[model samples]
Target: MISQNTINTVFETARVEEVIGDFVNLKRAGSNFKGLSPFSDERSPSFMVSPAKGIWKDFSTGKGGNSVKFLMEHSQFTYPEAIRYLARKYNIEIEETEQTDAEKAITDVRESMYLVSEFAKDYFHRTLINSEEGKAIGLSYFKERGFTNETIKKFDLGYSPETWDALTKEALGKGYKLEFLESTGLTIPREDRPFDRFKGRVMFPIQSMSGRVLGFGGRILTNDKKAAKYLNSPESDIYHKSKVLYGIYQAKQSIAKQNNCYLVEGYTDVIQFNQAGIENVVASSGTALTPDQIRLINRLTRNITVLFDGDAAGLRASIRGIDLILEEGMNVRVCGFPDGEDPDSFARKNSHDELVAYLEENSKDFIQFKASLLMKDAKNDPIKKADLIRDMVTSISKIPDRIQREVYTQECARIMDISEQVLVSTLAQLIQKDLTEANKKQKQEQKPFEVLRNQNPKNTGYSGGDPDDPRTGPPDGYMEEPGYPQQQQAEKVDILYRLERKVIEILLLYGDKTEEFEDVFLKSNDEGEVVMVSEKKQYKVHQRIYLSLQEDEVELSNNLFRDIFTDIIGFYHQNEKFSLEQYLMRLEPDFAQEVTDILMEDERLALHDWEGQNIFTKGKHETIAQYVSETVMSMRWFLVGKIIEELKSSIQPENSDNTELLSMVMDYSKLVNSFSKKLGRVMSRYH
Candidate 1:
């Protein structure tokens, strides 16, 4: 395990902006930096990095965190992986606690498995290059397939000996455990004896995106009728076939740099394509296309071109993958090689320049490719053409972008010689059906949460107390108060969100800075008129915000915001000596991002030097109790207004609390009447 002290050193030395900048291009935006969100497709910049807070936030996807969190989210790195990445970037020496034998044996299953896989990879590569039998069979097979000697070692190509126990005995002698060997699927255990799984096969080491050997893909050289041609590593903790793409480790950089990915169908296809000068290519490793695989590529580039042989079988595979790509909002293109040539054979046959030219010239959008592929079968048949149009519309509907759908629909209509209106209407029907089913699925999944909330109404949405929405009441309530819709109940929760969130933001950012504020006291006069009295008070921002929330007995409705506010307040309460950097370092990646977002919101404004404009912007040290009180009162007014709405909708207005709420709403109205919109209560009955 990594020592906590080492983790702390890494955190302290590493600047979040510096670490994230390696992956994203960020420009100065106020006191912080802003960039396009790497996690989503957006035109304007929404990803913010707060150097002061040591965190970042992607407003687009609601993802935020420190350097470690960004690495984990972007690269799918585990916590340890993320920490190690940051440590390496910052040049911090990783100091790990030594593990005892018992400690090591207990749960280092994954680590041990990784080590064994690495050892096996080296063993197979050596056997293929050095062993006489392996040289004659395995090495020759790779050479015959047009792979250079450099390519062989680059991909860690190897051979498992024909002898069943060769790998097993070698691994055992090398101090590797038999359990990990079997779990990695390197060794198959039977009742009689344990033996190597890929015996007599040429090995292809399959790697994770981090370039670690996760498993192997082996191809049998023998022509035994019953034996399978290819054998892949079984599903294990480290190797999930559906989630792993062959050559991704080598191709990810090129894919991101070129802004395009060339997806093929086999290990040889990927390797040959790479050798032929196309570095940004990944193979499906012979598995059927999966969404997880598509998502893996989506992280690197939004454009994908599937290269298939000009054959019916290859065309089918391309069609199957196209829908998935479009569903992810990716720009997908399809290219078919000359007849009787797959990616491997085609690349081997053509020169590098020729191969590149062919791909560029032939690549077409999936819609055009699919239309052509199906049109051959639909020729001269009116019924078949109609089915083809429907089929094309169905594929178009899978696209999430409305504009893309409309363009494709128009294209499909022109190609099929049908009315664009007909295709559009058909698409609408399909989309509606899809949405209905998706809603049903969501409701089914939410059934448990719904049940829990029903039992605990206080914690759930204020469904029973408030109107369906601020502007609209239920039909029963509408009948009772005809003007209710016109009155609009007046809940500007955005104003509340801004005010409440501002209080928390001030508390977190300026917790240590002392500020004086005008405090308001509410009282009734001798004549029964409400009166407001003000006095100046001084306190830290954190203390003031905490006290205000406590006095009001109010909590934020947004779960993430509420959780962060609670944690920040609690931290300040416990650790009187608040260190912003130290506190930020202790926060989890996701929550830390929230704190950063709050602290860094509109930081560009602060960073832009507004003092030069003769309009002073409040700094952390600025004393503005009046400003703080305005924020607190706005939130208080919003809550009071919400309660008044509840009271107006209450069945028993004559009840003391309901009657009391009416009088309180009226009293609050006098204070807000001038600047705010009209506010009133609903009568108990129409009469």
Candidate 2:
């Protein structure tokens, strides 16, 4: 188990903005930073980070939490792994208790798989460099393609031996389980025999963005006519080809730093680009791009440049991915090599500067590239031209940003030699169709129990309350006012709000401030008629408030306030400074959400855009902060007065002529006067 001290250090030292900023580009917005939501496909900035609160909120996804929760959600890291990640980032040493035998047994399965994969990677790389067959075949093939030793190691390029059962036997001899080896797809088993899965093939280790080996891709070396050129591991618990992108682990930092990514089609394509000094590149491993892959890139950057071979099939297949990227709200551009060349072959032929320059000049926006490619096929055929225009409009409609969609529409109109008005009308129709479909779906999927209220209600036919009953009458003594109950509810809400605000302010600002105030004393009721008896105590107002809440039976409607009140009572016992920053930094998402809801509910509209400007000179209501401050002071004074009244009522002079009773009354009066003076000072400051 992780020690409490370790957890405290991790929570206190890790900053939300610092941890998330590694993977996201955050620009300053007010006291917070704003960025596009990484959890969803969003164009506008809806992810906010508050440095003071040490938490983040994605308004788009409605997920908000402290730094640890962010890592756990974003990277799918386990709790322990998330803690270790932060510990590593902050240079903290972890000292954990040893696991028991049962824990060790459970760990064996995953650990065995990881160890075997690492062993196989090492075994393959050794064969490539040391064995004559691997050196003559696999090594020569890679060297001929201009891959240096560093590039080979960077991509974990390796060669598997041709001998069957060589790897399987070695792995089993190392105390590794045969079942785990088979599960990872490193070994194949039949009814009576088993062998290494990648025997006689060059290996490409498919990895997750965190560099964990998920699976492998292997290429056969021999030119046998019946042999398949390449084979990949079947989908397993750790590896899903559709969700994995090659070189993502290596390229993610560069992609985030450069604010652009280069998408390629093969393992060698990624290696070649990285070798050619273009680091922000990843490959699809020859599969169609999936939404999962798009979201992975979306977390890093919104701009993507797809590099394709200049062949006809490549262009045809590449255009299909453009629409998917558009649907994800990503900015996409296309760049192709010279005819008959791919990223691998082109990078080999040109210098880094020349290749980069070529890509820069040839890269075109999706609409322009699509138009240029299709214009040749639709030349002078009216039906084909119309179909092409509609296809382009369909792609444009997928863009979430209206401004970008309109710009693409204008570019398409110019490229196709069509009227701008025609394209605009087509786009408008498409948008309306999309909206109509969305509304239809929403209605069809509406919840069965949702309520709808009427615009107006008729009065009831009878009234039960007496006309002169004070309990039923308005305070002004007129006919009982309509919505009087609602008015009372509003007043109750205001009282709760003011009280909570004062408590939070004290917790945040004056938690360490210690000032002695008189505490009212109570005597036995029998002493009230004859003489007074009193007991005096010295206490802090903050402590008095804490004690009062503990003694009262009032239930707080706001859950967050109730929790904060409970925490305040605990803090009073501890006699420590109430750290609002630390509390907010470590608060759970549900609690943070509740706090935000309470703080923002029914705020003054005049303060919406105050920005520290005092434009309105409404006496003593110059700013929302000041108004709230005054309201809070009033509520505190009222609560103290109520406590004093309760104490006064407890005295009874009839039982005995006790001097203690008299002292108690004087102490109670003193407490009331001191509380009144303090409250007046607080109100005067705001006024």
Candidate 3:
């Protein structure tokens, strides 16, 4: 168990901007930072981070929270893991109570899978480095491939022994369940016996972006014609190859820092390029590109350069992935090596500078590269030439942004020696066809409407319970039951938000401000009725504000106002003078999220140029914090007046003069009048 002190230290020491900035590319927008939403496909910046508040809000998805919540949402890390990650990043030593063996045995399935995979990685590495067979076969193969010891260890390269049951027996003997081994595809189970899945093969552990070992890719050294040369772990709860790219964990920082990614085909390609000093490179491990993988890269960089071999198959694969890349609104450049040379061979044969220069000089935009490469083959054949134009148009049409599509179309027309009008017309047709197919698929997959009865009139009409009922509500649809009137609710929310802002502002900006106020005390009348009386005591303005509210029966209308009022009452009862910094620091995460939302949300007023209107914006009253406080007090008094009216309507004439009720009403009325006068004074001062 982690102690409270450790949690506090983690929260205090972990800088939110630094933590979120690792995964998101944030640009300064006013006082805050804005970035494209990592939770959704967005072109414009909608994800906002407030460093002052230590929180972030995704307006598009409505997911807002502190730094810990962001990690949980973005990286899928458990709470403990998130805390540990932050601790590691901040260099905080964790103090945790040791867990018993029995407690550790009851681990979650996903975490258990992770543990098993990690064990396999360690086992494989030991086999490669320490075992004679592994040294002779796997280590030799890696050395021949020009992989340094540091690179091999960094990538966690390993090898499984030649004996079939060596790994299976060892794992089973260690109390690691055979079922998990089979499920992770690390062991092959038969009727009589079980064997190691990647026997006699060198292992390349594949990891997720967060650096958790998800799966493995094994390469065979022997010439076994019956067996495939390379085999990979099957998809499981933790390992989805389509959604993962090898070397992403190592390349994420460089990719973000450089704002570009270099994509290649195999593990060796990634190693060679990184060893050649190109750090922002990842490999697909020879699989067809997937959208999930593209999005993973998209989160880090807006541009990608695909490094392909000069072979025909590599060219075909590159072309297939171009449309996917374009559809994601990413800029793509293609670079093909010399004939019979892959990225692995080319990088090894050339120096770092030579490879860097070659890439810089040879990289071409997708459309230009495709047109130049394919135009020669379709020179004389009219049908083949027409097909080539259509294919290019099809790729252009896949682009989601219209401006980008149009730009690509113009570039293609110029490169193909074709008329711009013809190319534009063809692109239009292709777009229409794509949209038609998309709409058809959407319609086919859409659920049939069964007419569920509308339960919430505030959201939807049909309050009679039948959705098909024509007479359920007005044609314009069910409006919110006018909860306290739209103008009143807006005013109330504005006032409460303003008041809280004022309190926070005063606390933050002028925490030591001292002013004397007449202390109001609650005294009991003869008939057990409460009466308010002002005493000549020089209390601070902040203290007087709370005492006046507590001594009088001011009914709060806004929920937030009522809550804050209750909290202040409790705080005043416990402490002589509340610590504003401690209050903010000790607020629960949920309350903090709320406070941040209220502070950052629109207050529905424009005062940026108000000073030019001959209005002398005075000290305190002119500030946003003072304005908020006045607004909250006004709303609270208004609600108090309404509640008094409701009570009066319910009272009988005989009870009108009752001392208890009359005194209560009188005290409340005084409080309401006091707030009204304060609000008026603040507004008049601002004007």
Candidate 4:
């Protein structure tokens, strides 16, 4: 177990932006920092970091949390690993009891793999600098490529020796496990022994965006046509080659700051650009670009400039992949070097100013690049020209943003001397085809759910609460005293979902805050009838909500809301003193994310002071007691109506239990009426 003091130190000392910054690129957006969501593919800035609240929210994925949560979600780190990461990052000394051997094995396997990778990186670096062979080969190779010592160390570039077992022997002798070596694909295992995989190759340590050495990319110096020139570590738990963007760890901040990213092909290309003073660049590590890789870059910026080497055939081949970036809704521009030069050669040949100038002046919008490159072949051949125009239209069709697609189509039409109507008609056909396919796919995926919904009609109307509204009732489709009729079971459940959510939101946000409350008590009058009386009482928010729910025998209709409510009540029982921050940390990830979303969602309103624009914002703190009571009353009133609706739907006028049912209905109606008076709200739906 981690000591509470250490956890507190880690939480207090770690700034959310600083911790997430290690993994994501973040840029200032007013009081907060906005980036593309690391969790999903998106172009716009929807991932937000609030340093003031010490929390971050991805509006795109609807996931939000503090520093520790970010580590857990992003790295899949266990609680201890997350704690240790924060402790190391913030320089807090962790004090924890030793775990059992079973626990150690379960946790240490992944950690051990990481440890082995880090050790290998260090060993390779030391080998490149200290060993005579490494200097003669690896260091010399880098120097000849025009990499300075600073660039070499900055990227943690290294050399694996040519000897078959040099790294294996070193790792085993140093007590590192061969299992981890094999798992990280650093060493190849045989029946009798293991040998290094990157032997005789100068190494590039592939890092996660946060700079953890997930794996390696090694380039062989041998001219043997038989051997693959570049070898990469096999996919392990730590690395997903398609998802990982090389140099993201180094370039994220600069990319986010500049709101642009330069995409290149090789590790050397990324390094050369950085060395030439363009800090916002990453390489796809010579792999075909994937949505995941584009999303990774999208997290930092919406604009991507892909640098193509002078091979027009290869460039034409890469143009298809460039559409992947467009499909992600990013602004893509293409820049190509002169024949015989790639970014590495180009950067090495030019000064910083020249390199930067060349890129800025040459980078053209995707349409322009495509037209310029492909136009030479089209050369006034009407048939070929039409094909080229259709090709441009297809590229434009991949863009998800309607506005951007329209704008690109206009530019294409002007350049091609074609009508906008023709391009737009083609684009519409593509989009409609996509929609038809998407709906077909969705139906296939939802076939089982559709069957279930058919079997259970209520479930169709019984959609659970929206993630954002946990409190009160869903604003959509349900409004109190707004000329709506009595809610059926499904709508009632939704209302209940909202109310229960609202009730829980209050409990979580102000659960332990002490406040004055009106407690109602029933007393027996002299006539032997119970009468209600109200008296001033003092209780915390959680106490008030829990007691009200207990008194009414009310349970939330939604499973998630019920579970959270029960947990809250149990938590309050175990500890009278509550800390919201500490409490959220202990909930399951799904629940914690939900709570964090509700808590930090008002940034737009709060940060912009929307009240200045005459927005009708609720006074959260000013009317805490009244708000709690009103919200509770609102829920109780809705429950009475829900039961009434159920009774009205189920009961028959001539049934044997008809009178009894009618009496029960009247009783619920009376209850609803009395609460309405107390709440000072009219139940127009009742009439």
Clashes of each: 3, 18, 6, 7
For model 2, the stretches where C-alpha displacement exceeds 4 angstroms are 1-14, 90-97, 102-140, 163-195, 224-228, 447-687
lDDT of 3 by residue, 591-640 (tens): 55555444444210111223345544355534533443454465455556
Candidate closer to the true structure by lDDT (higher is better), 2 or 4:
4
lDDT of 2 by residue, 32-129 (tens): 77777778866666677777767677756657677777786766665676788788889987878777888666654554565677788877888898
* Top TM-score model: 4
Please, what is the whole-model Cα lDDT of each candidate in the order they appear?
Answer: 0.78, 0.73, 0.75, 0.82
TM-score of predicted model 1? 0.69
Candidate 1 structure quality by residue, lDDT tens digits, 338-369 = 78999999999999999999999999988788
| Clashing pairs for predicted structure model 4, backbone only | 470-501, 470-502, 471-501, 471-502, 472-498, 472-499, 472-502
TM-score of each: 0.69, 0.72, 0.80, 0.83
Candidate 4, residues 286-370: lDDT per residue as tens digits? 8889988888877667899989899866596469678898888888999999999898899988999998899889999999998
Cα lDDT for residue 506, model 3?
Answer: 42
Measured by TM-score, how close is model 4 to the native structure?
A: 0.83
**Of 1 and 2, which scores higher on TM-score?**
2
Better of 2 and 4 by TM-score: 4
Q: Where in model 1 is the C-alpha error above 4 Å?
A: 1-9, 12-52, 56-64, 69-81, 87-108, 129-134, 440-459, 462-582, 586-687
lDDT of 2: 0.73
Give the range where candidate 2 is weakest over 10 consecutive residues by summed lDDT: 600-609
